[model samples]
Target: MNGIILPVDKPAGWTSFDVVAKLRSGLRWRKVGHAGTLDPMATGLLIVLFGECTSSSDEFMDLGKQYRGVVKLGVTTSTDDLDGDIISERPVNWDEVLVRNIVSSFRGEILQRPPAISAIKVNGERSYKIARSGKELSLEPRPVKIHEITVVELSCPFVTIEVTCGKGTYIRSIARDIGELLGCGGSLAKLRRTSIGDYQVEDAWRIEDALRVPEFRGQR
Candidate 1:
């Protein structure tokens, strides 16, 4: 296939590389890549690069992203998401007004620490690798911008929020922070990327259907 940016709706439980590998085999070719990875537990828009397009990652990687997620309050997970082990829990004491106000406070720029089980590198080794080895590291917090955070629903233990933020923002971090702000622990229960700049998940090509249709647009 030639060069093109293909929008794929990544399925949950599949690593970003899994989608790339699936395309590579089904298309009987190589040179496939993806921009802006989603965690294995999150499903949504994944922009894929094909053939010569693999060289254009920077174009999309820096774009702002949007995500809709559910934060499970009163519970803390090692990974900040359901994929990790539950480390602790606390009693919840929050109301809709408090939740809305707390979520709104996250708007604008803020510092966030990426989860230990993340792709971030420390001394050339993935942080997750180090974390899985039973070693603890005080990872530095990085600046990220949250343009907007809208609280969609508030039901005590479950808080749903939609976030519009810059490239480096982690929804899991937002959940954890929100929980901390409310004096209760928190973790991401579900997450889905709705958009990245101009690309929307609604228009994304389904991996299952794409594999069956041989002469897709990416074909040479």
Candidate 2:
């Protein structure tokens, strides 16, 4: 079968691999792969490569991604996002100006610690496995690039930002750090990827749409 690279708009409830599993079951041929993994809480553009397209997956994996997301102050969770258990809370003392300033400061190269419930590996197991076990799990901070971060909206408790970042950037970490700077814990409230490199979510197929009418398919 001829291969093709398909761009999909992954929904919030679906894991990256879930899309692959569904495609494998519903489509002809067998090879299916994704350029990157988006957490279950995230909804965004996911690149699905079939057969020969899978061989070139690395080409798109390093491209920068842009996201529109919300960071809510005064509350924090174990996963640094709303999907996890609330671990702490504090009164928000930040105004719009202060919040925008903090968000702007992150628009460059910075060392960031991946969230505890991340998929990073440690001692042969995913770090999130350790985190779910309620054990101590701390990963070293690594450098990541924030190409640009613009404050889109700010309403004291909720700060909305659009971020364009290089590979390895974590938007959740940005939310957590912003809250810490404001003296109130923060967690990611919402996220949607607008683009990845030249691929836009608007041009991607929704999961349901793909199942019924795939935007791209192989020629057998």
Best by TM-score: 1
| Superposition-based RMSD of candidate 2 using all C-alpha atoms, in angstroms | 1.6
Q: On a 0 to 100 scale, what is the lDDT of residue 32 in model 2?
A: 86
Candidate 1's error at 52, in angstroms?
0.7
What is each predicted model's overall lDDT from 0 to 1?
A: 0.90, 0.87
Residue 178 displacement (Å), model 2:
0.5
The digit string of per-residue lDDT tens for model 1 on 1-220 reads: 4676789999999999999999877865567899999999999999988888889998899899999999999999889998889999899997889889999999999989888888899999999899999998757999999998999988879999999999878899999989999998899999999999999999999998877876654542
Runs in model 2 deviating more than 4 A are: 214-220
Once superposed on the true structure, which residue ranges of model 1 sit more than 4 Å away at CA?
Answer: 217-220
**Cα lDDT of model 2 by residue, 1-220, tens digit:** 5687789998998989899988766666478899988889899899998888899888887999999999999999999999989999899876777787888999899999999888889988999999899899988899999999999988878999999999888889999999999899999999998898999999998767776755455443
